[model samples]
Target: MSGNVLSIADRQPEDVQRRAVAAVSLQRWREIEHARVVKKGGVPVQTDQGSDLPASLDAWYRSQPVKPGRISPRLTLTDDEKRAYGLPKSARLIALRGLGDEVDHWSVAVFPVMGGYVVGVKAPAGGGGVGVFWRLSHKASDYARRLSVEHGMLIRERYA
Candidate 1:
């Protein structure tokens, strides 16, 4: 296969996350937010939506579409899309969710940046990408673990 056929999957997950982070520019850095924890059905805990952001990025993100349902059980990627967007083609789109609940109210958008793609995630609670929203509803243990212990939602063992 040609070099162009090479994808981000070949790299480690941490490397892919790091490289994508590194590709962000000082100016664009101002565009995204961080440490924004939000309630399942409420606004973000905090953010800088008023902070100056690129018009293109702003418009682009605003115009992007959303898919509330979970795309996959795992952070799966559209192989061709990852390459087209300058992400590690091998790495899946990283989405952390306790379960697929309310996924239909969220969207995973891709914004082109200095060196790589900024994986823009939009949840119904708030509207932003990347570090903008830390959704508690979709947190890892919120679904699987909590249900398993509280409601007896678990896999029972069976002899072969």
Candidate 2:
């Protein structure tokens, strides 16, 4: 978990804010990142309400780091949900709640790679606040143990 809140840091002149990468589209990421910088300072990148940020916030948003494989964790996305929530076209289902047949809903977060914090955002009614955790699961695969241990991810029997 990040001990310091998302603060306005000195962005090097050479640092360019990325519009999109493999995980998200260029046009979409800009709009969402813009809202995030100005609104809740990093929580609720988008909300049930709405976001209409000023021009300067856009720059600040871009200054933040966004890399490949870092994306919103929702495997399914409806057309409307994509636009409404600023979701990417493709996403990974990173949880197995209950029987894991299907997920009802997903909370949004930035899942940083290795030692970085998982900063999450929930609804206002659901209690709005950032939740940060820094450690990775001991049984993790590439980055996270969202599904299960890497060696046993698919075939428990090892028959193949």
Candidate 3:
């Protein structure tokens, strides 16, 4: 009998090609959403980089799409804002909290920068504002907790 073997490319049927195309489309959509969210100063729940963000921020990020225009701005830290906050260029988001009950209210976010962690707060009006740089994550977390308690807001973890 003659040996008949399907090549690797032949193994991929039209359904697989369709799936691949769909996957690419989904990825493009995600990328666009990620850019929009980041531009608006919001952290994306799922990133190609990885899920180093706290769970709360992840949840908030996931919910943004469901409520389109309600995504609060001024949640991400920019290069200039990082400099003002004394955060390193490698800093990444770890957690976040809203200062008020409304979705458009001011929010605070924590980033793990070199040497330690930094917690920055931003208002809806749009500004870098003030932030506290701590030598430890726990200390930064404690401060965030205190702020949450004081403002009667709920804080959520984005990293661990």
Q: List model 2 lDDT by residue over 10-87, tens digit each.
A: 342323324223235765787777787678565544454323331221122333354679632323434434454332
Number of clashing residue pairs in every model?
11, 1, 8
For candidate 1, write residues 71-106 as lDDT tens digits: 433334354333333344444343323312233454
Error of 2 at 144 (Å): 18
| TM-score head-to-head 2 vs 3, winner | 3
Worst 10 residues of 3 by lDDT: 94-103
The candidate, 1 or 2, that scores higher on lDDT is 1
Query: Best candidate per TM-score, number?
Result: 3
TM-score of 2: 0.19
Best by lDDT: 3
Q: Candidate 3 local accuracy as lDDT?
A: 0.54
